[model samples]
Target chain A: MWARTEEILPYALLLPSLVFLALLILIPMVQALLLAIQADSGEFTTAYLQRMAVDVNFNDAWRNTLLLIVLIVPLQIVLALAMALLVNSRFKGHQWFLYVYAIPLAISDLAAGILWLAVFTERGYLNTAAQGLGIVDQAKVYLSFENFGGLVAAIVIAESWRATAIVMVILVAGLQLIPRDFFEAADLFGANRLRRTLYVVLPLLRPSLQSALIIRTIFAFQTFAVVLALAGRNMPVIAAEAYSWYANNRDAHLAASYALLLLGLTIVFTFVYLRVLGLREAEVKR
Target chain B: MAGIRMQGIVKTFGKTTAIKEISLEVKDGEFLVLLGPSGCGKTTLLRCIAGLETVDAGRIFIGDRDVTDLPPRHRNIAMVFQSYAVFPHMTVRSNIGFGLRMKRVPKPQLERRVQEGAALLALEPFLDRYPAQLSGGQRQRVAVARALVMDAPVLLMDEPLSNLDALLRLQARADLKRLHREVKRTTVYVTHDQVEAMSMGDRIAVMREGVIEQCEPPMQLYTNPASQFVGGFIGSPPMNFLRGRTKAGAFEGEGFSLPMDGSRVEDGRELLLGIRAEQIRFGERGVPARVQVVEPLGATALVTVLVGKVPVKVDAPVNTTVRPDQNVSLAFEPADIRWMDATTGAALAH
Candidate 1:
């Protein structure tokens, strides 16, 4: 009597997409778990689990991935904040600037990698610009660092350019959603630019920034294309390790183990992120 | 408290004119309300004074200093927005202390002033709570406390109480009046509600289409609205108007006639006739009307009477029962009539 059968129609209509999502994401995830448990011996062994930590190459790949997250997370947040703030302001051709910032997001990672490679070439635009600006008479082969810094820089540039749009997009949305009256109230209080940004903008932006962080961190962990293009055959990213196990070693069991490691990393970080967000929500609730 | 003066304030947004050469003065320590329907440019005018919105052509003087071009932060004024606009992240103490902190008042002084503002707002228990953790009224009070912390001479509020529930709104209104008395800051409030404007303001400026139609004390606006629009807008149950011609021949009309007042001008010409619903009386000496509807609202009853071809609503004391579709008659002394220019809708000055 509370609600008629007609009211349930809209909910009933949602079952297909729900089922599709279950098949696409949930089923595969469940299959990975089953495959994790079932070996030829039909006994659950700790062999695959031990491989994730004990295998030197997998360990190094994960270590590098974590390193990438540590370096890129803060950098991406800062850059995105700057971009969102700049776009939030009034200027000539502001919309055009926003559209320009957003364009990298639409390009495929393969395309972006190829495009960035042109700048890295000896006779590329960087060399030409250096000659034109007279900073350097000729282009130097500068990108080949012995360590992973150059690779990190390349990934940063490519990933920053690609993923920054989404952060800027979210922060810009948050910026717009803040009532103009709040700023005016701050203004009335004689809050200077930095004070206002730190106290008001940052605090109001926590939930939004937290959400962006989780998404971007997961994205950073899944950083395959840019890492692959920049890091090349020698560097050991998790995805690169999986590819090596499958195509090179032709070991499906090993490849599945590497894939499962990637999944585990994602789940752990996601759990931590969700737990932090829940705490924040609880504090707000209190 | 400082008086605010504006000379020839004009604000145009591209081709659309928002405020067209508005000029007014707020007396020191006075509560002046800009009362108008939405988009009448009342908010824009308030913003121009608060230094939030710029005026295309104007000179604003706060206590005789030209503040028209100064940035809002430089202007010694505070504002409370309709949304409460409290910073969601800060505890109530920090939110209240934000202004003092901006000026880099020594930390002790900052703490003391924050405490003072909190005490004034009765926000002691909620000092550690964030804006998001508070009720709507609490948030609004925090916003007010934040405004108070500045200790500015003028407080500009744009529909500040509009977001509160009805009972809370009433309480907030009383608190605002009390706060103004204690703080003694010249306040300029903007609202469309006549009740709010009437009750809270020392003087009310009734605006229409970006122009001040009339500015007067509350009783004057009620007893003597400068125009028919002001009359209609500033009253509940509204002033009733009828289109008719005033002629020497018994004030002739299609379904109604009246014994014409001898002193009436524009005779034999079409003009609008307005009467307050409260002024109409029910009796046998008047014109017979069909009782169309009766709406009882506790203490008062509003009766819709069909007189000839025109329907008039009259407010009467409750317990006077009359069924719809019954016969009724209404009469009133002719002196209560208000006349307006039919074309321009401006009241004809008596």
Candidate 2:
């Protein structure tokens, strides 16, 4: 019944979602910023930020988080790329392989942590298998607090297995968007499989790769319940420490600062991904 | 340049046979156009020779090498796709040099060849640009340049100009002919356009339902089509067919009678009378027909006429004053009439 000029229509239609975003997302972010920087007397202060700096758990959590990202993202990208290529090959029953590969996506992060713990903990499936295979003389406590490297390895394996599916799905969609003729042309030009993947598929899949990297990196930064479920008190990641600060220490200020720091790191990494792999608007049009 | 030879090539996809037992040869340094409609196995046959499609049963030879079982990389043949298939991410120079780069050709030679190809296609100005920045015609030229730089003895093109606008198609067609003349590679080009086949091909192979009906030079194929299908498929304002019966030494239709040789014809037997539009002319004494529609095409006009219920088309000069609905006598020489078996649609011996 009402008509509006073309210039005004899009903004008018976007007004409702903008209002919702301002209320739900912006307000919370502002409140967290306030809580993180303000002292108990409600005065602007850096006391909580300094306290967070001095916290023992903060240093360990920061190091563990960085190490986890360093280990997990590349592992996931490589595994996801391999899985995506395997599915793209249209091997026998590839549709079934897609379903099988996506099974991890249905498993929650906490569930995946517990699932792998059953294999990696002392007297767990991995230990029993190693013992049965005569690779290990006896059952060993692989996830102990003292065995920091082994615990990190266990967490890396679990996180990669659980989250690689998301990246794989993104890569598969990107692979499908590339026209078949490009590969055929490459073949006609005497490119073998490795050369085709390196030259044709990878370069064409830049945008998808950028998105997958940014999303996975942010999700890695926010990783919480998985660390808590697998390591309990033995490992303290930023997210897990933020949880402990709020629940155990009853210090929401420190918790908010930790959360803000995680968000900042996510933004920094996302910026890097965009800078390195982003397709120019003109390039995307091609 | 090397000739291409296929021996009883057969290819099937699922339950549908795309190319059925075809054996064809493109002579060395010859321009051979495979002319056929869509789904007529022309593209599949070309792909088979390029090693893109594996044959179920056949042997393909490029020059002296048997390349039937080799991968496309080993076949040493370049193909220009109908879609142009230019790498959108790469510059025109990189695209043109891609085959050479894959072979690890020294950078100097690759650059020289790429430059030569770009100059040949008049793409030197766009050599640094990506395919997306170029127009459709330019993109197709880049594809052609990419193929040319391969310097392979055999080249395959699948309706490469089909994606261009009408005016661009005309120019691209001329460019392709000039390139063929300069390179003299054994080219197997496929198109559904008869005009392209007629103008560009040194020899044209007309295919239908996966089999080649006739393979000959343009004028020979036009003057003597091997079957009713070839006769109907190869011309504009297509060859007209009138259902009738042969009586004694004359062919009789519903409202007309014409004299013909009856040595192989049975008396009072059903037959089809085929005549080209250009062969018929208006005359004072001939079969009487009323004009229906006239389409003036530059130098000539195609006139449609009705002889009782059967429609007939005659090519006339544009200046001729033949108006619609006017009764006129159309004349054709006895030798111009092609007789076909009414039931089988195969050409009947004269």
DockQ of each: 0.50, 0.65
Error of 1 at B300 (Å): 5.9
Tens digit of per-residue lDDT, candidate 1, span A32-136? 665655576777766765665576687778888888888888888999998888888758888888999999999988678667767765676778889899999
Candidate achieving the largest TM-score = 2
Per-residue error for B21 in candidate 1, Å, reads: 2.0
Candidate 2 per-residue lDDT, tens place, A71-149, comes to: 9999999999999999999999998989988999999899998999889988799999999999989899889899998
Instruction: Please compute the TM-score of chain B alone for each predicted structure, in the order given.
Output: 0.95, 0.97
Q: B221-331, model 1: which lDDT tens digit per residue?
A: 887777779988988877877777777745555566877764757567777677888999888766567898899989899988787667788998888777899887777
TM-score of every model?
A: 0.86, 0.96
Output the worst ten-in-a-row residue range by lDDT, candidate 1 chain B. Answer: B247-256
Writing each residue's lDDT as its tens digit, candidate 2 over B21-81 gives 8888889999999999999999989888888889999899999999999999999899999
Instruction: Give candidate 1 misplaced runs (Cα > 4 Å).
Output: A1-24, A27-39, A48-59, A90-92, A128-134, A137-139, A143-148, A275-279, A282-286, B13-15, B240-308, B312-337
Model 1 chain A weakest lDDT span, ten residues long: A277-286
Superposition TM-score, candidate 1 onto the true structure: 0.86
Backbone clash count, each prediction separately: 0, 0
